[model samples]
Target: MAADLYPSSPAPSAASQTRFQKLRKRLHKDRALLLLALPGILYFLIYKYLPMFGLVIAFNDYSPFQGFFGSEWVGLGQFRKIFSDTEVLRVIWNTLFISFLQIVFAFPIPIVLALMLNAVRNQLYKRIIQTVVYLPHFLSWVVVIGICVLFLKSEGLINEILKSIGLPAIPFLTDPAYFKPLIVGQVIWKETGWGTIIFLAALAGVNPNLYEAAVMDGANRWRQTWHITLPSIRSTIIILLILRLGSVLDSGFEQIWLMLNPFNKDTGNVLDTFVYFKGIEQSDYSFATAVGLFKGVVGLILVMGANYLAKRFGEEGVY
Candidate 1:
């Protein structure tokens, strides 16, 4: 039995080797494409992967003069300090609140807007609307914040309207209660149009025949949309949802920074803004790095878990 089993496993092993050689040859033939991808590969390596090495700073008493290698290692001291800081808890609360609001309120607006636009038969009107909506996305966060400041200020257009209607001027930007809503509104206004592009593309890919079949079954426009349109785009929705979950911690840095004031600081402070304050302003680089690194790791876990759950539900999620 041993003799028979040991006799020439060589053929199968040789076949595997031959297959490997063929793959290598095929890759060699695709050298031009590989070369084309080299710049992007190098960019990620240098900018993304290389910077990851700096995560060591999170465990150290990082000093610019001492640099990474010579810095004193403090291990979990930074994390302990972060947890003990009262403002840190507030920052975490603000970040999660803003992110949650965005996901809950702003996420679906794009999909609904896309569907509405898709239903519009008039091409000129559709294009005009699309252009108007997407324009805000291209505007710099500074410009968007400036516009918000103008519109949401006590004497702004909205307050002016309130005055005309014999109502008191509302402090939209300065009030802590209104800060979360303002952030949500800003995100919806600036990003909803841009977010629609993907949904629109997904909608375009949906087979018209499915809608026709639904119609033949005596389905109304709304019924067709429910049965055919949504079902067809379910995978796209799942994919985008997974992608969004990946960045759940990243509530806009620039926009929040620009819009934030001391009066609303309690509600407006997020992880990103906190990092700027701690790392750049206070020069506590190590502590800030630890906080940021912790957030990143948690975000990764969330995305991966979400993607896995989506796959388990038989949906196409971001792998």
Candidate 2:
């Protein structure tokens, strides 16, 4: 029994040799593509994966002066404090509300835009419109928000137009009521075009003959879209949706941080803002890291659950 086996003691078996040979052949064939991907692989390894070791700070009562390992280990104490806060409920409510709005109002606009653009038969008009929409996606958050300020402020263009029409200048920036809508609207305007690109690619892969057949069967554009276009891109939609769910809790920091004020603090305080304030502004790194870890864990669970549901429904989900 003692001599029965030790792993890696024996020489490679025939099946193992064949598998190794096949793998070597594949590597040789795909070497050029792998070389092209080398920079991206190194980028992730350096910037993304390597930094995951910093998560240790989440379990410590961390201080920069104390260094990573030198920090006192509190192990979940920070998490407990997070949930124990009386304002935590309000913060959670604000985060969920914004996230929900983004998913419902922002996510689908891309698909709709893609579909509408796809319907345009005039190539020049379509390209022009695409260029116009795509411009916003390239704008930095600071510039984007500045444009919003220029348009939506009390003395801004929008209010000027309203004043000219004998209407009151609405408190769009200061009012809590407008905060969530403004955020959602900003996201929609900035990202909707960029998001549509993927759906358009999926749409391009669709068989044109399907549309022709549908027209032959007396189907209108709407009918063709319903019967062919939407169904063909169903997988893409499912994949994007599953991926979206993974980031549902990550309400952005820079945009919200800029827009957030005493006026809209009740509605605008999201997880990202909370992390910035707690971690950077207040120097409570452990608490902030704990909150971030909590968000990440929830995101992972949501993604896993969504992927499971998609597979159950016979769809190929994002792995």
Candidate 3:
């Protein structure tokens, strides 16, 4: 009765062995490719992952002279300081606010630009437009800010034009209220064309047949775009958005630092600037490390959460 009810155990299949053999064969075939990738692999190990061990300083009252091993351990002490400091909290607020503005306003400009370019029938005009827009991206922040100061300073070109037009001059750079908008505007102007490159590439991959079929079905250009063009690039957009969410706290350090001044410091003080002031100028390495570590942890959590949400929504994520 037992034998009838329970079948005898079958012999183990050689599937595992076969897979191992296949993997070995594939590795041998891709040896040259692996060799080509070796430098990049080493770079991550040496610069990225290996340096992670230094994060231990975040938990201690570290001193450069005392060294890593000799530094007195004050676990979570710096983190406690960060939470208790109103200034730090304010900085966090500024960072989040700027990053939010960027995500909401700056992120979509490239897509819109790409769509407009895609709709253009004249390739020469499109190329000229693209080249002009892309030129700003190559300019360093110092140069960009210099150009901004030249145009946006109180007595600069913009105000001169406004005066000629009998309109009052706007405080584009000096006012705290205008600071964030200025930052977002700068971001859009500098990076929109560069960002469009990726979207334009993705759009190129979208089948022209989809548009042809839509046309045959009596769909207008707007309807074809809404139904066909956008859907085709949906996955690319989602993946990029997920990646953007990962850096939600990283308001550009160089851009903000170059633009930062006493007048707009209240709205412009972000994590990177905070770290620079504390670590470099003030020589408070431990607290600076703690703040940086905290930022990294938050970034990791955000990336993981975004990836999860993306997967849940049936989109391919950056994982």
Query: Which tens-of-lDDT digit does each residue in 14-126 have in candidate 3?
Result: 86777767777898999999899877877776678656878888999989999876899999899999999999999999999999999999999899999999999999999
Query: Which parts of model 1 are misplaced by more than 4 Å?
Result: 1-46
At residue 183, give the lDDT of candidate 3: 88
Candidate 3 colliding pairs: none
> Which residue window of length 10 is worst by lDDT in model 3?
1-10
lDDT of each: 0.88, 0.87, 0.89
Which ranking of candidates, highest lDDT first?
A: 3, 1, 2
lDDT by residue for model 1 (1-319), tens: 1223222433436659987677678879998997898778777766787679889999999999999979999989988988899999989988988888898999999999999999999999999999999999989989988898898799999999999999999998888898888889988999999999999999999888888788889999989889888988888887777777778889999988988889988889999999999899999999999999989898889889888888887876668
Worst 10 residues of 2 by lDDT: 1-10
The TM-score values for the models, in the order shown, are 0.84, 0.82, 0.84
Candidate 2 residue-wise lDDT, 1-319, digit = tens:
2122223323567868977777778989999998998778777766786557789999998889999999999988888988898666678778888888999999999999999999899999999999999999999999999999899999999999999999999999999999999999999999999999999999999999988888899999888889999999998898788777777887877999999989988789998888888888998888888888888888889889888888887887668
Window of ten residues with lowest summed lDDT in model 1: 1-10
Off by over 4 Å in 2: 1-51
